[model samples]
Target: MIVETDGYIDLIQYLTENLPVLSEQQGSKAGTSSYTLRECFEEQLSVQIMSVCQQNDLDQTMRIDIVREADAILYDFEEVLASVLDNHPTLEQEEFVTEFIGLIKNLFDARVKA
Candidate 1:
């Protein structure tokens, strides 16, 4: 469930689309509201990660576990996405969507099964 990019927009969308139930369970509306989740994940995760990236001025480099909580969040989303995709085979996979879809598939294949 590594968020393979800079700004984390894709990662935020992935989380919101997948883990709506997390908000109910958490009872903080953290994961339910896409806007709130984006603000939080960005303020909490993206900001720190971007700071490092900006300081280094690196176009792209591997960032592992920038936010300790992200691992759990990603796992939750991966589960949700995998279940949805598994149930909905008619879902289209296109270039614009494949970045997130492919990552979710990889997450399911690698992390969920393992």
Candidate 2:
């Protein structure tokens, strides 16, 4: 919900800094993000969001709360999310997106229950 409200970039930036250190290897880290690494998700989401806005005739730039706009365009996500992942051809991207969605959903679910 916050992602929808604030847009995903802030969360992505926070996660880039806070994403768990799952494992480390030989001066390389896996499953974490560098600030620039965040650009990939930001760019892809922006592109997909723009496409959704265009198709729905809703200007995303006019959105005061991105998640709210996205909340209204829920069906579009199921379609766009796949494309976003498709645009990125790396296991890390897939894993990051999937896991991030899971975490966000779980968080939202918990909030609703409360």
Candidate 3:
């Protein structure tokens, strides 16, 4: 199932709007345990993606298709990061990419579970 461009746009918007909350959650969860930037980013991303999937009532298959479609449009990870940052300057690039990776992974995981 090919996901529409509009769908990807909506997903991006959802992610952007929720970033601050996600980042705060990550910080709170870590407590005094220090994590590398990568680790922190990944955890936050995963949580946010899962939340979005649940909220949207997106089944495993639909989540997978959406990730695949978004990936196809961006071509590669670097490009995906660049595209997201370019579109959302207010967001820290590293954080945005980390969440993007989490979104992609969770979407694929949904497919695997199905």
Candidate 4:
């Protein structure tokens, strides 16, 4: 639930296999779309981290450390995803971002339960 490296790899695989392709009718500039996706991810991650910390009754210091670690992991995962998407130009960015956010949320929920 803490999403170690293996869990991150699983997330990447899940996104690759399950993400839906956007229809051609939904047109948007790639840069704007990417920025929107990034913003959504940041916001969702913040909320999820806070929820997890609160549910688990973590102290302030522990919450900060866990958030910091999660952020770092997410940043690294984003970089890896960017590289993969760069190589596979046909994939829809929006779907990937959406799936990634969902995976992160699920991971946080599991961590809280743990």
Candidate 5:
């Protein structure tokens, strides 16, 4: 049910822009103790993707693939994405949370099925 449609484009841009800040807000406990999978995903996938977004080398598709791969490895990836989207106070689309989760699941399935 997913394709490279307008929703996909919006989801990707939103993720590319906001996920980094969300991760920062989530804030990894630096020198405290052990880390949760969410923490790892935030640091590895979210933060790293922000850096990748800053660089001019990778295309949007490449960025998407990176997110998909990261999702494949992280448990509850959909929840993570939803939380990121849900927590945004300035988010324009108020009702896009569930649909965005589906879009992300599509990408996640693509990576996993491959």
Candidate 6:
């Protein structure tokens, strides 16, 4: 769970660093993020993370065998947002929206909080 949490934090950090315009456009701000949940499963399941990132990246210098693994996680994130909501009765629209907004705020904040 900790790694999953850290991965979400890292992904949000990466996004904030790389895609400020998109993040702002999305209108999400952050708490109780499901962002890295998929990454945790990918790490526990197989070695697909590195290839996914490499394939998606525009960098020509990207490594073929990198340690970064979060593609599956990203996929899972989409699933949670899109499909899982329909299946899980306990998940509420407001709760997800709140958490998503919190995550965005966390990214925008200059001082990272504990």
The runs of at least 3 residues in candidate 3 whose Cα sits more than 4 Å from the true structure, single-residue gaps closed, are 1-33, 66-114
Q: Each model's C-alpha lDDT? A: 0.39, 0.43, 0.48, 0.57, 0.46, 0.36
- Clashing residue pairs, backbone N/CA/C < 3 A, model 2: 4-67
RMSD of each: 14.1, 11.0, 9.3, 5.2, 12.8, 13.4
Q: Write the per-residue lDDT of candidate 6 for residues 1-114, one digit (tens) a residue.
A: 222466566755554443322222222332244544333333432433333333354344333222232343345445444423222122233343445444433432312222
**8-88: candidate 1 lDDT, tens digit per residue:** 446557556644333333333323333332233324334444444444433332334334435654554445454432221
Per-residue lDDT of model 5, residues 1-114, tens digit only: 223445545666775565555444323332233543244344545544455445436667866766665555344345445555324322222213334454555553453344
lDDT for 4 (candidate 4): 64
Residue clash pairs of candidate 1: none
Give the lowest summed-lDDT range of ten residues in model 5. 86-95
Model 5: lDDT to the true structure = 0.46
Q: Write the per-residue lDDT of candidate 4 for residues 78-108, one digit (tens) a residue.
A: 6654434332222355555555677776766
Candidate 4 lowest-lDDT run of ten: 82-91
On TM-score, the candidate that comes out on top is: 4
Q: Using lDDT as the measure, which candidate wins? A: 4
Off by over 4 Å in 6: 1-76, 85-92, 111-114
lDDT of 3 by residue, 1-114 (tens): 323445445655665575453444233233343544344444555565565566676768877765555446444323333423223222343445565656555554554355
lDDT of 2 by residue, 1-114 (tens): 344544444544545553332122122333334433334444445555544444454334444444564454343334344333223224454456546555444434443344
TM-score of each: 0.24, 0.33, 0.33, 0.57, 0.30, 0.23
Tell me the deviation in Å of residue 74 in model 5.
1.5
Q: Which ranking of candidates, highest lDDT first?
A: 4, 3, 5, 2, 1, 6
Q: What does the lDDT read for residue 93 in candidate 2?
A: 47
Runs in model 5 with CA error above 4 Å?
1-37, 76-114
Model 1 bad stretches (over 4 Å): 1-21, 25-35, 54-114
The better candidate by lDDT, 4 or 6, is: 4
Deviating ranges (above 4 Å) for candidate 2: 1-10, 16-87
